[model samples]
Target: MAVVGGGIGGLAAALALSRAGHDVRVFEQARAVSEVGAGIQLAPNATRVLRDLGVLAEIERVAVRPEVFEFRRWDDGRLLSSTPLGAAIEQTYGAPYLHVHRADLVRVLAGAFPAERVAVGRRCVGAVRRPDGAEVRFADGSGTAADVVVGADGIHSAVRASLFGARAARFTGYVAYRGLVPAQRVAGLGLGRRSTVDLGPGAHLVHYFVAAGRLLNVVCVLEESSWTREAWTDPGDPAELRAAFTGWHPTVRGVVEALDHPLKWALFDREPLPEWGAGAVTLVGDACHPMLPYAAQGAGQAVEDAAALAACLTGASAADVPAALARYAELRLPRTTRVQGMSRDNGTRFHLPDGPDQLARDEVMAAAFGLSPDIDWLYGHPVPASSSGGREGARRG
Candidate 1:
């Protein structure tokens, strides 16, 4: 198996397949594997998959386990709701919600695979499927044929364009500024130890500790008419960011003010693809269905995809590859599509304008956070067992 794009999804697919006793090679366009941002929230579903893959212990060492997720008003720091996540979530879901540095998680996955198996700077130009296998061509005028090709390239996937042709990604009309500050620095500002979301009129601020409380990751998303660029590493003007949340709560301003250098990303998402597999090739992660950050499941869903793909392909014959790929798609498509829709809906709900609706939303959140079952469907559900082979897949599914 050959996995394209050495981001988290690609590396994860390579690791999972190799662990399943297959020879897998991962091709990454970057010179090295490194994440651009500060933090990623790994809900229980994703953590359980990683735990099964045998990387959970290493992840836990560097990840922060927050006790609660608190939502507050942007104007006066009034607490609207708080969801208990540490013990309650683990007891219900079978795993803890982990907040870790993106780079740390990438390192964990990359280290699990043999160094030589990951070919960096090998940009995938296109791929062609044959009766026997699939041929992947790289921009450096080289090619490799493998029994299966997985396109985990992400939202701007080259393999996706080569297969489905070019389709514009819908801009959500929002720009996000993200940065990480030393936790000690945040503490000096008198900010308490907690995960916080300050909901304002047209924007919101999410702050949380990561890297086991060594650093605080801050993300601020605001509605905008146009974007300067789409890159996650684009330089952002802190002054502009401060101005956007000018009159926000003092805590919100303190989090933004603690930033040294911040990067801005123009948020965009796509409707779920009608198909994820073609011949001996299939797509995973953002390449198949990109979602907004509201649900904090963009990376989580990709990790889920990797686990499902590995489960479907394990112990399958060459003739069974197509059926396996279809089964993977059939199992993942509906769930991811629902998540994508929910993320969009949550974005609107979070940025609701002032009215009875906003008041009602606040009331609902205040009440929902107190209940254990209100969020069980999201944080407690496990991935369904794979159904490729009758009993074996069922056991792992």
Candidate 2:
């Protein structure tokens, strides 16, 4: 099998398929396989898959276990809602919820994936289905054929574009600034081992412990009527960041001020595709369903997609590849689509102006505080995996 893009979803898919006793290779666009981001929240839905992949323990070693997730009013710093998330969540969900630096998580996954099978600097241009299987084409004037080709490539996936025509992503008119602040710098402020978000009109700020509580990851999102930039690597002006949060709580302002450099990127998500793939070629992760960051399930959903794809493909023969890909899509599409919608809805609620609707939203949240059942579909769901190495195609090497 050929997997395009060695990102979290791609690596997880390769690892899951390998453990299910299949041979897979991961092709990464960059010269080196690394992740560049602030932090990622591994809700139980994701940690369960990482545990099954056998990397959750290593990940937890460098990750922080937040005791609670809370929301507060932006101006007055009044707590609006709080949910317990440490031991209680682990017991109920069958996995731990964690916050880890993106680089650390990628390092652990790369360590587990077979290095020789991973080829960096190979940018996949597109893919085409053959009678027997599928062929993946690269920008380097090279191509490879496999029984199945998976496009784990991200939002602008070339494979997706190749199978389905090009479609532009809809920008949400929101830009996010992300940075990590040394925990010690904010020690005096008493920011505990918990995830917190300050909600305000037209904007919101989230901060949580990561890197075993050594750093606090801060993500501030603001709505802009006229600003339209999309690059993810653009350096943000700290002055502008501070100015944006001028009237926010002191703690919120302090977090922004401590960041020496923050990455600013316009938020964009595509409408879910009617179908995830065709023939023996299929997509996983953001390639198929991209969601806003409001729900913090972007990474979690991608992890789930990997596990589902592996489950559907295990025990299938070369002739069964197309059916397996189709099954993978059938299993994942609804869940990811629902999540995409939920994330979009949350984005709208987070930026609601101070009005009756905002007050009603706050009341609903406060009333639902500490109710894990409300999110059971999200945190309590499990991704299917093969208990034994699958049928005739099982390759133990």
Candidate 3:
């Protein structure tokens, strides 16, 4: 098996397939493998998949486990609702939610694969499928053929372009400004070291500790008429960011003002691909479904894709590869599409106009948190060692 793009999803797919007793090689475009972002939230669904792949111990070592998730008003520190995440989360979801630096999670996933199997600086240009197998072509005019090919490249995936014709990604007309502030520095600003999320009319801010309480990851999102760039490292003016959240709250302004260097990304999403596989090739992660970040399931769904792909491939014959690929799509598409829709819905809810609708949203949130049911249907899903050739089942723990 050949896995392209050595990001979290690619590395994870390589690790999962290798553990399933398949010979796997991971090709990364960068000179080295690393995550260049602030923090990533690993809901129980994602963490459970990581644990099954055997990287949970290392991940937990560097991660900060928030006791609960709080949603508050942006004008004043008024707690709208809180969901217990430590014991209640574990008991209900079968795993604890973790907030950790993206780099740390990448390291844990990368370490699981053998160093020799990972090839760096191999930018995948496209893929060519043959009767026997698929050949992954690289930018340097080199290629490698394998029985199976998995594209875990990000939103702009070369493999996707190779299989399905290139289509423009839908820009959500929103820009997110992200930065990492030291925990002590945040404390100095009078905002205690708590997982705080301040929501305003058209903008919101979420802050949490990462790197074992050493640093705080802050993300501020706002609806915008236009964005200048799509890259994650695009320089953002602090004044523009402050002006977006102007008159929201002092703490929110303080966090944005304290950012020495903040990065901005114009959020883009795509409808789920009609299919993720063709012959011996398949897609995973953002390559298959580029989702809005509102649900924070972008990485989680990718992790799930890796697990399901491995499960379907295990013990399959060469002739069964197509069926396995079909099974992978059937199992993944419904849930991921639902998540994508939910993320967009959350965005609409978060940016609700100040009126009775906003008050009704608050009431709904409070009631949902108070009557929180077991989320095992979403979090405790287990990848079967083999596809049952039946419709996938959604069951709670």
Tell me the tens digit of each residue's lDDT in model 2 across 1-397: 8999988889888888888888899999999989886898999999999999999999999999999999999998989999999999999989999999989888899999989999999999999999978899999889998878889899999999999998888877888999898998999888899899899999999999898899999999998764554464579899998998998899888888888799887888898898999898999889999889988898899889888888887778777778888888888898889989988998899989999999998998889888545378899887796744545666321
Give lDDT: candidate 1, residue 189: 64
TM-score winner between 1 and 3, please give it. 1
Model 1 stretches astray by more than 4 angstroms: 189-193, 228-232, 370-374, 384-397
User: Residue 73 deviation, candidate 3, in Å?
Assistant: 1.0
Output the number of the lDDT-best candidate: 2
Instruction: In angstroms, give how far residue 61 of model 1 lies from its true place.
Output: 0.7
Better of 1 and 2 by lDDT: 2
| Candidate No. with top TM-score | 2
lDDT of each: 0.83, 0.88, 0.82
> For candidate 3, what is the TM-score?
0.93
Q: Judged by lDDT relative to the true structure, which candidate is superior, 2 or 3?
A: 2
Ranking by TM-score: 2, 1, 3
Summing lDDT over every window of 10 consecutive residues in candidate 3, give the lowest-scoring window: 388-397
Those runs of model 3 whose alpha carbons end farther than 4 Å from true positions after fitting are 188-194, 228-232, 370-376, 386-397
lDDT string, candidate 3, 1-397, tens digits: 8999899899988887877777889999999999886898888889888888889889999998888788888777677888777677778767778888999999988888898999999999888788977889999999999888999988889998999888878778777889898776667665543567787888888888888778889888888887556454587788888888787777777888777678887888888787997999999999998888787788888889988998887667788888989999998998888888878987888888778999998887777773244344566666555332322321110
lDDT for model 3, on a 0 to 1 scale?
A: 0.82
Kindly indicate the candidate among 2 and 3 with the higher TM-score: 2
Give lDDT tens digits, candidate 1, residues 1-397: 8899888888888877776767888888999987876788998989988887889999999998888888999888899999788887788789988899999999998888899888888999878887976878999899999989999988888888888997878888888899899988778666554667888788988888888789998999899887656454587899988888888887788889888688888899898889997888899999999989998988888888888898888767777888889999998999899889988987888898878999999998888765445256666657544332243322111
Give the Å error, residue 239, model 1.
Answer: 1.1
